[model samples]
Target: MGRRHYILPDCQIRPGDPTDHLDWIAADIIRRKPDVIVCIGDFFDFPSLSSYSTPGGVEKEGARIKADLDAGHAGLERLMAPIHAERERLRTGHRKRWEPRLIYTFGNHEERIDRPAKEDARFQGVLGTHLCEVERFGFERYEFLVPVEVDGVWYSHYWQSSHSPRPIGGTVDNRLNKLGFSFVAGHEQGLRYTNRPLPNGKTLHGLVAGSCYLVTEGYRGPQASNEWRGVVVLNDVRDGNMAIPMSLDLQYLCREYAGEELQAYMDKRYPDKDWSHLA
Candidate 1:
């Protein structure tokens, strides 16, 4: 009857603790039971098998990488199992009213999967399997970005602009005020929204869905202090209106489960000397 609320969770997975943040987020999503779930990308840390290698460029010789990948898969399954189960649980009764959907978009890390070489095979295989699983659950997948309409508002993962300045402006007011559509996007890993006055005496609204996982320890330099993660809830968008402030909360779900061992390992592998200032 009105704008449907969509729950978007960002960067659900990474090479972190054995606990797996996806499992936690999945459980939380099922409990909250939103109309749809969208993943902003980087759902998997190293989307390509080639990325897992020693500094000498030697790949993991045997089952070491596979084992780790398998472990990651198992963790994802554990997290998604409930979502799949709940879909079935809800489908049996109100097949028409409750057809939950899952949507995924590619992130920079995942782009590595499409890189040149046989090593990318692992990434292709893993993502292919994930796509199939998502389809089985009646979810849709978009490439880098796709436009969506909610309550007459248009949304996309990336926005186009002629200005040569920063790609993303913190406020929606400057981005979509005159575009005549409400917009939502994710990739910046921070929650932001802006409402700007239009020439027609109305206002334009924009929203940025934030991340839900921990900031990778490999990050250093000026950007080292800018780490944050969280999930977003689009309360109302179907009634031709934008949700005020665009609900979001910062929670260290992944960091909490990462455990000290993993953190130490990451710190050792990617020393602060190699950290970068950009996210």
Candidate 2:
């Protein structure tokens, strides 16, 4: 029998970003009870450690490491709260626990945590993945860019180019041609999926769906940021085959779980920001 897998794209959870969507995801997980849950990392956006700004620049001001870590931890707690509650409820009822396998593949943003320690020996033991306490949440954490296979499909934050370390940039079909296997990744914004038939009678699936958080990156501007933000559910998955793939976008999730329209929610929460894309 094939297993159902839930895939969460890049969340990039950070301080100041709204995390209500995570709650929606957790609720959906409770309803679906997928056999496996995979987070394509970047769960923590450590802007404090970002190299995008000059050292000691105004943009870096007031960006505390603790704040970044705390925000991510809190967001994670929120994401798991409903699931935990469901587990407890089941235990109380003497029912079997819905203990799905949790897997987290580190992304580029989370890799920023190591820069400080790698630069100076003094910070070596202090800064690392342990501080995120992902394992505490029962997630089997994989290092940034490392691929892990589950139920015959492979997953990574993003697959690298054959000649360079940078992530392979292309459409789903292009990636399928290059990698030539069943792979799922999160890094680029929006979603793209394609599959090809193999001579051996199995199919190869490729998917890239990145944006999953409500927070917008100013650099992407309105047009780019407007791309779909959501989670994916793969069903009948076994031996690198996914018979059914479903995309639950933010708009749908908000309406289904929170009883609120996504655009309205965004406007009410971030009144000053422009979300013209939703229009």
- Please report the candidate that would top lDDT against the real structure: 2
RMSD of 1: 6.9
Pairs that clash in candidate 2:
none
Return the clash pairs for model 1, or none. 3-238, 151-238, 211-230
Winning candidate number (TM-score):
2
Supply the global lDDT for candidate 1: 0.53
- Model 1: lDDT of residue 85: 81
For residues 188-211, write the lDDT of model 2, one tens digit per residue. 889999889978889999989888
- Looking at candidate 1, the ten consecutive residues that score lowest on lDDT are 270-279
lDDT of 1 at 97: 42
RMSD vs true structure, all candidates? 6.9, 1.4
lDDT for model 2, on a 0 to 1 scale? 0.89
lDDT of 1 by residue, 129-153 (tens): 3432344434566655545655565
